[model samples]
Target: MDWKSFMEGSKDLSVFALALRAVILYIALIIATRMMGHRQVGILSGHNYLVAAGIVSLAAIRMLNPESSLTSGIVIVFVYAFVNVLLSYLDIKWPKAIDRKPTILMKGGMFLRENMLDCHVTLDNLLGQLRLKGAPNLSEIDSIVLEPYGKISVIKKPEALPLTRKQMNLPPKMVALPTILIYDGKIDEMNLHQMGLDHEWLITRLREKGIMNLKDVFLAMLEANGTVYVSV
Candidate 1:
C-alpha cells in the first residue's frame, strides 16, 4: 500500500493512527515496568524485554483486518507482564546468582587476562571503570572485578599477599553449573525421577519458607553450597 494510504485513518486505524497506538503502548509499558519495581538497567532476557515488538508486528495485521479486536494487544501486554514477573522474582530470590555481582577479574595486579577474555571485557574498559572507583595505580588496586551488571569495580590492595591456585596446587579451572529443579513454574519430573530426587523433600523445604506449591515458583536452582533457592 502507498504511504499516503497507510497514513490515513478510518474507524479502522491506518498507519498514522497505528503509530499513535504504538506511542501510547510504549508509555504504558514504561509505567508497567516501573510499577514492577525491578532494575530497569542492564542485560535483560529476550523473553523479559518490554519492547513494543508484538504490538508493532500486530499493527499491520490489525490494519488489514479492520474487524480485529483488542484481544491481541491485550495478550501481548500479558506476555510481557508474565516475563517481567519471572525476571523480578528470579532476581530477588537469587540476588547473587541472577543479578550482577562483582567477580574478581584481576587480583594483586597479576593480570587475569584469561578471565577477561572469557567475560568479554577489555583491559581498557576495566581500567576506565577502575579509575571511576579511585584506583589510581595498578599497584594500588588489590582486585578489579567485571560485574555481571555491566559495571566494573576496583578494590584497593591491603598489605597482604596474593593467593595463587598453582602455588596451592588447586584445580586449574572452575565450572559453575546451574541446578535445573524448576522450569516454567513446574518441577522437572523427569529430572527428579532419574536423579532419585524427592519432591516431598522440596515441599518440606518450601513449607519452612511458607511457600506451598512448585507451580507458584518461577525459577528454582540448587547452589554449590547444597541449598535450594526458589523464586516466585
Candidate 2:
C-alpha cells in the first residue's frame, strides 16, 4: 500500500487540501445560511427545509469530490439559497399565489370532515394536536385552524374563555410598543422617519440622557409612551 495514498484517504486528496476544502465549504454554507435569513434556523416549513437540505448536499459535494471546483460549489449553494430568499419575498407579496392558506378544520363546535379529509388530517391527528395544545374538551372548542406552516391554532368558545381586564369591568391601560431607533450604534433612519423624527430631534433626546456620542449607544429604543431608552 502506498503510504501517501493511505494517508490521504479515499479521495487521494492531501489532508491539508481536504481540510482547506472543508473550511471553505463550511464558510460558504454559513454565507448561504445568512442569505436565507434567520427564519431558516427556526421551525422550517416544507420548502424552507428542502432548500436547507439542498444547500448542505451541495456543500458536501466539494468535500467529497477532490476534482470539483470550490468556486463552483460555493456558487451552486448560494444560488439555491437565493432562490429560497426570492420565493420568500414573493410569498410575502402574493401569499395566496405563493403559499397555502390556513384551513379551518373545526368551527362553531362542529368538525368539518370534508375539510379535514382534503387536508389529509385524520381524527387522531386532530385530537393529538389538540391534546398537545392543551385544548379543553372538543365541545368547548370554537375553532381549530391548520396554519400554512402545519401548526394547529385553537380558539376556545367564549364561555370557556379565560377572564381578562375587560370581563372584570376594569379600565384598560395603554400599552406601549417599543421600536428600535438605533441598533449597534447605527441609527435606523427609516424607523426614525416613520416615527416623525429627525436627526436633530434624536440628538437632542440623546443629549437629555447625557449621551453625547451616538457611537457610545449600543441600542436606542423609542416607546409609544414618548420615552427613549438608551443602552451603552
Clash counts per candidate, in order, are 0, 0
What do the candidate models score in CA lDDT, each in turn?
A: 0.64, 0.84
Model 2 segments beyond 4 Å from truth?
1-10, 64-69, 170-232
- Tens-digit lDDT string for candidate 1 (159-218): 544677987999775545657778777888776675567888778877887888767888
| Model 2 agreement with the true structure over 52-105: per-residue lDDT tens digits | 888777777778777666767777888889888888888879988877889999
TM per candidate comes to 0.47, 0.64
Cα error of candidate 1 at position 173, Å: 47
